[model samples]
Target: MLIRLLYASRAAEAVTHELIESILSESRSRNPALGITGILCYGADIYMQVLEGSREAVNKLYNEITCDARHRDVTVLHYEEICERRFAGWTMGQVNLAKINPSLLLKYSERPVLDPYAVSGLASVALLEELIATASIVCRP
Candidate 1:
């Protein structure tokens, strides 16, 4: 069965471009073979990632993240079997939440920052959809 897992966590250390790049590099290299696809949204010290794939693969990845030293307060925002992937185009798409328009962020959350931990999973998913609609994500084919 296929599943989609949405989760959020705080960076254990200050977030940097290099750190994000390292994570994306690892994800892109590892995910496609596992039949996984998803988008990663990041800003400040927060991370929100969506992983879609077989139940086994997705679950394993989530578990790894939960135990990863780079993250803390790893909270699952959503998880469900899905008929199809909302993010099928990229191995691991990315969106820098800092670059997103403040107005768009405000539309989803109480403030202009993307705080997945403070909002419902549905709202976070909606924000991701909006990011896709606005061509905010960048990824490799």
Candidate 2:
């Protein structure tokens, strides 16, 4: 069965552009072989990610992420079997939330910031859908 997992975590330290690129580089290289697809959003020292794949793969990946040194206070926002992949084409799409419009952020967040911890899982998914539709961020192979 296919499953989708959403989680939010605080960066253990300041996250830089190079660090983000490195993470994406590794994800793009590893995810395809594992049959995983997802979107990663980062800003304000917070990260909100959605992973979709087989139950085994998604669970394994989430477990590994929980142990990663780069993340702290990792909280699973949502996890469920899904009939379709929301991020099917991207092994790991990325969005720098700082670049998105403040008004858009206000739709899902009260602070007009990227605080996934304060947003519901469904709202997080909706925010991602909006981002994708706007072509705000794209992952290229």
Candidate 3:
């Protein structure tokens, strides 16, 4: 089954444009073979990534992502079986949350790497969706 997982975490430090590109490049190269596609949003000191793919593929990627030292306070906001690919066109789309909305963090989450919704709390799928929609509109215009 196709899996969709939305999660957020805190970046160790502010991310540079080069760093963002490098991360996205690595992510696309690593997951293209597994048929995964997703968007990554970074705001303030946080990183929010929504990944979708086969069960095994998604699980494998999540395992590696959780272990990566670049981020902390990893929280899975949403996870479920999906009938279709949400990001079927992109191998690994990346968005600088700052560029889309410098206040994206305020629209979705908190800081300190240990926010109140880190676990068993409100999930902000709306915020993620808004980011996606706004980014698309801006890019298309």
Which model scores highest in TM-score?
1
- Candidate 3 local lDDT, 46-130, one digit each (tens): 7777789998988888888888888787878788899997677677776655555435545455542223255332445666566
lDDT of the candidates, in the order given:
0.94, 0.92, 0.69
Cα-based lDDT at residue 91, candidate 3: 76
Give the count of colliding residue pairs in each prediction: 0, 0, 0
Model 1 residue runs over 4 Å out of place are: none
Query: Model 3: which ten-residue window has the lowest total lDDT?
Result: 112-121
The digit string of per-residue lDDT tens for model 2 on 17-97 reads 988998899999999999999999998899999999999999999999999999999999888899999899899999999
Misplaced by over 4 Å in model 2 are none
Residue 78 accuracy (lDDT) in model 2: 88
What TM-score quantifies how close candidate 3 is to the native fold? 0.78
lDDT of 1 at 66: 96
- The full ranking of all candidates by TM-score, starting with the best, is 1, 2, 3
Determine which window of 10 residues in candidate 1 has minimal summed lDDT: 132-141
- lDDT for model 2: 0.92
